[model samples]
Target chain A: MRYLVPLLLSTLVWWILTEAAQAWVVGVPVILVSTWVAVRLQDTDSGSAPTHRLNWFAVPRFALFFLWQSLQAGLDVAKRTLKPVPDINPGTLYYYTSIPHGTARYFFGAIVGLFPGTLCTEFSEDTDQLVLHVLDTDVDIALDCRRLEREIERLFKLPAADQQGRPA
Target chain B: MNLAFDIVLGLALLLTALGVFSSKDLFRAVVMFIAFGLLLALVWVRLDAPDLALAEAAIGAGLTGVLMIDAVAHLSANTLQNDQRDDQYDHSPKRPLWLPVISCVGLFVLLLGAIRFRPEASVSLPDMVRDNIAESGVEHPITAVLLNFRSYDTLLEIAVLLVAVVVAMALKPAAEDRVHQPPPAHDPILHGLTARLLPAMLLVGMYVLWAGSYMPGGAFQGGAILAAALVFLQLAGFAVDRYAASLLRLGLALGFLVFLTVAVSVMIGGRPFLTYPEGFAGQLIFFIEAMLTLSIGLILFSLFSQNPPHSGAVGHQGANHDQ
Candidate 1:
């Protein structure tokens, strides 16, 4: 029962890769072995613990939000770079994140780079601080970081109370 | 139009080669070399050799790029006190410069002569390959030639890889030096990427291995993808090598052992060495390829992993130095 999700996923991947029913001769063993390895790796890596589950229902909403933000931010950066004067203030800003450590926290870190003008460069777990290099530090990056963190928290189904991640 | 494209590609390849040779910065040279590998892969594709293209891109561009960058990082890390210069590591006594020039000119003339006066072969190699491909157990001519007609060459290639990896293992730094280094801090981004991408990589590796029976994909390409996945996991701070040491050692030699066993076992059945029994050739070849994929993947990954982490100071920045 514990291996059901990983097993199904591996089998689905195997079927897709081979696309022939006869391939199951080799696929069956490969799928089983891969699922076992996945289970083992997850067990050893605490960050990938199964407790934090992604809400599939919220994925499309998050995806659309992410894509739109990335497109806008990408253009913004491009416009700045293409200017004669190159209107930009390149500086680093440290922002404390409220998302707890693990896959969700990492997802937050990953998406922070795509947010407008900010690229997460150094993430200190002990301090819950994300050192971001921004194209224009003049903009209010805290608001954007909080909003993105909230979306990721929702996507991972963490409780609202978990926002007080490490007490500053 | 095709000729024009080829000419442009050739020029670009030469330019990248020049960039690689002329760049003062080691990092830039490595990057240019990677570009050269990609262009060479394109040339292989234009020549109608998808198999060579795949192998070249995966090994030459991808794996070699990572290795070269890792080496450059190691060099820079070791020489932090000195300015980064092209000749910082050139400690060898300077020899006569004309030695290289004469050798290069001599080799160029020899190659030109060989190409201009190449003899006509008595056998129509391609037609012969086409004729025997049916009996070789695979539809793809390259796979047929590699596994069936010229399996000895493949066997020796695997043997050579095994020897190279064994040497790497032997030359790896002492465990005590590695033990003192701090474990890389878990980066959520790299961890998440590895978590999501690993299964997909495994699937692609398997697919490429299976596709060799009918297309350009094969053990080498599949193995390289698998190795990349392993390296990704290690870079993401997973202790794959520490946990899977015994299993990895077994995997590193499985292909060669299986191939040798099959070859010798078949000889006991009054058949010649490395020749599969008539009807069982397909299954045998597939089995051999499967083992080879795993072994090759492990071997390549070992080569990368064998290098010691540069120093404890660079542990915080996990971008280049790996344990």
Candidate 2:
């Protein structure tokens, strides 16, 4: 039942994305089978990490923010790297996250690279932390990260971190 | 201006290729090879072959990079931890390089000579393809060629992929490649992104697959994207167990099974093998492609995964990193 909602939503998405009207006769089956395969593949023991918990209403707003930030990042990277002197200080720093260790942590690794002046170099299992390479030290990149995390928390509607440090 | 862009792209490709072959550092060489693949994709675009561009960019560059990086990580495990210099991995070839160098140069010249002196064709091939494309089921000539005009070739290609998966499974890279890796730390950023991106990526993959009927996309490109999304999930800490493994195996076999069933059914219905009935050609082809898309997606993902990749099971590292 946990997989049902995502499966149905994904199937609908699959049909529309595949332009089902072209061959309506066979379209529904194709999308359903593929979505089932996807759902099966994403089977997880960690309930808190499931994507279905996300607040769908906040998605577009988050996407816009992500896009604008990425553009800014792109421009910043281009300027610093393309300059005659390469006005940049490259260094790595650790970021401790409270999101679950599975899909959520992995998504952050990919996304952090797109953020301005910061790239996720590694996520250490022992430390429960991410190693981020930053272009500038003067900027409060951690503050930016926290802000992004706030937006993401709202979007995913992940249980707020409790006093005991476990997500509810 | 176009000529200049072409020249630059060509030069970059050549340089990257050379770097890939000649670099002493194994890591640098692999990186250069990935860059070479990206440049090759651009060259394909310049040549007006968007289908090839998409495949090259996705499979040739993206997935290949992932595989090579995985391999390098395995290789460097010993050298980095032990602080011992392994001189066995020499840059120079053990055998004389002259023979390979001479033969390659000879082949290059011969190919150049053949193209330069080739006779002009009396028949216009594009006109021929365009003329019969309507009867070929799909609107795109390339898809038509792949599915109808020369479906046997596509079948054989799927067979090749099947053989690759079977061989990989037999080789036990599946067991040694994964281990009891620690789960990822809580990361809200990743959690949020996955929630948003996975479905969207899947949608884009389907878009590409569907568009292949009329445009510059296909099962391979779409499957690569799907495989990438799954890989992202895997890297994020998703566990694959026995049940998931069997389901993935089913996905690996789905394409061939569907294709064979469709072909044999057509024969049983008194039509020639692989020839669809008059009014149902498009529907049949779409059905086959849809199955192929899932199979290809699962198979490609399994190429790197161990354990039950499709349904989520715990995996042990099969590829032993002997330091």
Candidate 3:
């Protein structure tokens, strides 16, 4: 029963790829065998703490915001490049984040990657400090990182980074 | 309008290629080479070869760039900046360069001759393919040519890829640099993103594979996309188990196995080897592609595992998610 979801999904994938209903004679068996193989191939630890517990509602909202931000950033960067006297001051700085270590941190990095002014060069393992290279030092990039951090927290339902382990 | 676009893209491609080879720094060369690949993909697109373009952008520009960058990172760690100083000081006698230069020139002239003569004889090939493409089990000319008209080439290609993977696996997996600290397991945002993205990536990968019968994608493109997604998951810190590694090896070999089995099985039915029974060619090819897509995806992703399959490579949440 635990394997049902992946099985169904893999079957759907197989059907989409094969696309011959009449060929079910061979397709069904092949699909089943392959799906069984896939199930066996997955890491056993995958199901222990699946990421689906996140608040689903914030995802689309975040995606829309991110896409718009990306467009704006791309245009801004393009403008900076083509201008005769480019008003840009590039510098690297550290952003201390509260996003949890595992996927959340990775997600945050990915998000930061798309933003206009900042590119994340590295994240410290010892501390939650993200090294960011920014196009403009004048911009309140720290505040912006914090704002994104808050949105991620809302989306992931994480406790505040500073307030971790605090009881409700 | 389009002419200007073509001229610019062509210039960019040439310049980027020149930059890649001429750059003294290995890192700079790798980056420039990736740029060249991307520009080449654009040229493929301008030439109306979308299938080739897709493969170029995905495998050529994308995966190749990642692979080269990985190689550069490892190489740079112990790299000597001696090349710069050596270039300025020790000038060895420039002998033995003429033979290689002459051979390269001869090869170039030979290619130019081929291009000059191609138009006279090449026109019939497409017409000939189009005339009998219906019986070839696919709507797209490239797919038909790949799977039916010239299946031996495809079979041999799959065998070669299998050999490459086996050879790579024989190498000791690179020691991971991220042995510092294990990230906490309950990263809610990462989990959420993975859960959302994985399904979509799988869907797109399968869609590309399915659409290949009539469209601009096939096993290779779909397989690359799926492999990238799987690698992304691993890089995000999913602990793949040992049993899963063996299971994946089976999956990795599945494509060649199925291709060979079908090829041999068809011979038992009195047809030539790899020539599917007339009525069942489409089904058989579709089946083979489904298997090929899975096998290719897993094999390509496994190439990036940097760990022995028996141990099941662990994905540590490194500083960079894109890694």
Candidate 4:
């Protein structure tokens, strides 16, 4: 039912947005059949589907944080670019992941990559480490790692680890 | 206010382009290039091409950004020395200044001559569709052109999209399988904002899509917006796996199927191929546009995701420090 609502909502929104009213009789059936086909395809490929746990109340705060961070990062990049000579020292660094779940880990990698000067190269399962290449190795690498770790951890509600493991 | 805004936007565009061209870091260059697309969309809007503006925002800025980033990601994984070599290459080459100056002068002369020699007027195409506009069904001229006048072009374009997808699939590396790792759970504040913004964005996107028939938007713009909103949701830690793939496939096929079905139905109804009966054109046009939007959005997102085969559910891990 939870999934059904979003699906219906998206379908309806898609229908209306496309102004499919004239062809609604035809379009509705198309959308439904296609949507169903899509669902079956997902089931076959990924095996498990994501369940939406609606926490409607928490949305606005996250958006504000994202906006603020994006703005800050944008400014930082602009400043670095305007310098007389680019002060960048490129290097690759490996960081370990604390997020256990696959979904959480992917989200973290994407968010960190969103920032300027960082590109995540690979995630290794054998050693449980993430490889990131950075343009400015002179910048505080550990600090950036901690910032990303905290942000992602907070977003996913993952278990906290100290230098060892403990609740923060 | 407008002037100030324009100045800022212009500067942003210049900076973005300069960043794209001048940056020694390839990844940074890719990111800047994406930013340049966004800035270019703004420029399009300022130039009073809202249709182009919307398309630029969705396909140009959004989709292209995804593709470039994916390409960069792929490149980074395979080579370390290549980056160093590229840096060296940037400094080693310069096409002589006089060559670019001569080319620019030559282009200017050709454009001026072409403009000067152009005919003052030209005959418009036969208005066979004017008396039949109401009967032809679609109201918008461009839509009419697309579905009724030049449907073969539209069909071929869809074929092109399919071909591009297949080509990309074939070219993608076999070992590059990985899913984006979820961000660590962030503060409640961040999550709250994302949730609030998503529905509103979706709402606006729908409005753009629906309003396209009468106003500046249609499916392509609307669908791109919708896709972007979904991408944002994905980034925000919204667990949204249920219909992503299937929805994508359906979206891709929707336009081609509907257009074909309707064209065939018309034939069954005793009209020529691609002919719409009286009062059915607008609806049919709407149908095609909607499907096209979905297809475009899906194709673009898939292009951006650029997932390689056989990587098999690898989670997006953190930045790997080791090159």
User: Which candidate tops lDDT?
Assistant: 1
Better of 1 and 4 by lDDT: 1
- What is the per-residue lDDT of model 4 for residues B25-100, given as tens digits with 9 covering 90 to 100? 6667777887888888889889877877778977777767765665555555544435565345336475578987
Report every candidate's CA lDDT: 0.82, 0.74, 0.72, 0.62
- The predictions' CA RMSDs to the true structure, in order, are 3.7, 6.0, 6.7, 9.4
Score residue B320 of candidate 2 by CA lDDT.
26
> Listing candidates in order, what is each one's chain A TM-score?
0.82, 0.78, 0.69, 0.69
Best by TM-score: 1
- Candidate 2 wrong stretches, greater than 4 Å: A1-84, A89-134, A139-168, B78-85, B93-97, B173-196, B306-323
Please give, for residues A13-50, the per-residue lDDT of candidate 1 as tens digits: 88877776578777887788788877776666564433
Q: Is candidate 2 or candidate 3 better by TM-score?
A: 2
lDDT of 2 by residue, B58-141 (tens): 889988887776666555554545445655564455798899999999999999999999999999989989999888888988
Candidate 1 or 2, higher TM-score?
1
Candidate 1's chain A scores what TM-score? 0.82
Better of 1 and 2 by lDDT: 1
TM-score for chain A, prediction 4: 0.69
| Per-residue lDDT value at B157 in model 3 | 88
User: Who is ahead in lDDT, 3 or 4?
Assistant: 3
